[model samples]
Target: MTSQEEIKVVLLACGSFNPITNMHLRMFELARDHLEDSGKYRVVKGIISPVGDRYEKEGLIDASHRLKMARLAIQNSDWITVDEWECQQPEWVETAQVVRHHYEELISSENNNDDVDTVRVTPQLKLLCGADVLESFGVPNLWKPEDIEEIVGRYGVACITRCGGNPEKVINQSDVLYKHSKNIHVIREWVTNEVSATHMRRSLRRRQSVRYLLPDAVVNYIEENDLYSEESEQKNADVILAPQRYTCTN
Candidate 1:
């Protein structure tokens, strides 16, 4: 039984977490540190986003395995917990809807005993995203023009900086977003690491050492499952080298 005063929550921290990495842990620590230093809201938990059917990428591992890996990686962190609701959904859903629903559920649960209760409900939600996603905000098909209102109007977002993109582009585009809803906020911290899941996968297939790239648990999981074998690596290399054959669709 947790006390109401000890239930402060912040930052939804959503992501595929395909294979959790040191970067992910670093971001969590940074967010918590920021909240503490600012002396504002006390962050009580970090929510992990499990993969759903809506992912556009091809050749993803099973969600169960991914979820297991995420759980293993965060096992030592008492403040972080895995949220499997996204992966468990029976149908595909939009990102905006997911955000709204999660907050709504939190609010509803908090007020569940309102009939004769003296409990005050306090629910705050923040969306965590990478800079790449922020740059692509104009194109999140999941978010309709109005859905943006529901999101920024109701919750705050934490944006982490990533490479290969300009922050100004994201800010300028966000002007239009602000017109719709003003609750959106961005974090300017740059993660500095060039690690990405695609590169990790490629490295694994090539039998290259991925030390210090991904979390130890994820590396172990990949090894135990025999993921990304040498044959696949060779095939990928061949495809990259032999690539220029475009045909006329007419």
Candidate 2:
């Protein structure tokens, strides 16, 4: 496609980046490559927005630490950046709201720009996620129907194929997803890295080496903060010392 015909797009990934692992960062690269290779869209930016503490996911950590780890994970990336707006929210923000907020924020900035000589095209904001999240749509009441429509039908979705999940099957099962299947792109992970924040947390809890699982800076920060350690878990008044369960955030 010609430059003038190319659609500008921004990818927004919202999740509990508890201790942002390599896989988390890899998603952005994979999505960017898939979109650009399609020859219809040019990926202009990638934003990682960590869920707030109010989300209270089983293994989620403080937003501050998660935010810092996310920033550290993308220190060398040229296009990816972390946005703290969601983390700073008083209550947990839904995925749809997060995408909408960023989309509007970008438009506001473009409108206020003083440089008239440079023309800016409004970018299409797409929700980036793993197939696991796509499958979550089928869970009973896990997500509202209209919110699903707003996110997938309006902004669009770039879902990465994850192990043990079928994005296409999930999309086909739901009428809403089927209606907007054209807007959803399922990206394949040719490299097949199954590294996840849950596995990383388990390794850390056992005091195992996560040397290459995440960035050196993030690992070092976790060490310095004594996070996810047995002692740290015991110190938390809210955490119960269960035999088979690790009560630490990612």
Candidate 3:
């Protein structure tokens, strides 16, 4: 058996993260825990990259706000990091490119390392998504075939099955994905709250309490910044006065 130090694994999650619900963070945690429990892999880092504004997903806020919210949500965790490169892109970038972008960075850093340990192996990069996103792969034109091949075939994918998501059926349906099926890891979520960003937004719109549904700091950040509220647009003054101010400083 290989020693823990010999192998490294990192998960890159790309999504709208419009307000970043608790489930978004749980996917990373669940994936990492599953990988670590396998004994053959050592989880290293996790990255959260929100989609750019150009994608124009309905109810999605500016990338900067989403990015800040993501950062705030992960502040307490030492291993997770937020990458802004995706949101910074001038045009709408596909999800595969987002995964590759960070994967290449990890490779580049490893190449530049002057103190390489002979026993340490190269890190493994995998795209992290919920089952819904994985199911969407079969949705016509929802994801480009080339992009899907590049992501799952190359870096691979780690998914957490959400309510009503059937990874097995989807894999059985897609020839491209099934070809690299060995690279895929799908875990059924157990303990975490199954919250959705869309649902959270709707709750906010209805002026309902979302406390504890998400990271407290993130909830506060959402409320303090007036994001997702029905009248949030009317609160632009505060949003502008301190657009970057996040509720959690930890």
Index of the highest-TM-score prediction: 2
lDDT digits (tens) for residues 1-250 of candidate 2: 7977999999999887868998898899999999999999999999999988776666666889999888888999999999999989896677778888999998998898889997977899999999888887777656777788898899999999955567888899999999999999999887768798878888999989999899999999999987786554343346432211232111
TM-score per model over all chains: 0.78, 0.90, 0.87
Which residue window of length 10 is worst by lDDT in model 3? 241-250
lDDT of each: 0.64, 0.84, 0.79
Per-residue lDDT of 1-250 in model 3, one digit per residue for the tens? 5674445899888888878877788888889888888877778899988887666555668888998999999999999999999888886677777777787898788777788565435588998887877887777645667888888898888988865567899999989889999999988886655588878888899889998888999988887888886654343343322111321100
> What is the overall TM-score of model 2 with all chains considered together?
0.90
**Per-residue lDDT over 1-250 for candidate 1, one digit per residue giving the tens place of the 0 to 100 score:** 2343443656676655656677777777776676555555578778887666444234455678778888888888888888888888775445676787778777777678656646655567877767665565566443454655555556766667755556556556676555633445445565468777767877877789887887787789888987666453343342311112111000
Candidate achieving the largest lDDT: 2
The reply for model 3, stretches above 4 Å from the true place, is: 4-6, 116-120, 231-250
For model 1, name the residue pairs that clash.
none
Residues forming the 10-long window of minimal summed lDDT in candidate 2: 241-250
> lDDT, candidate 1, residue 87?
81
Which regions of candidate 2 fall more than 4 Å away from where they truly are?
A: 163-165, 231-250
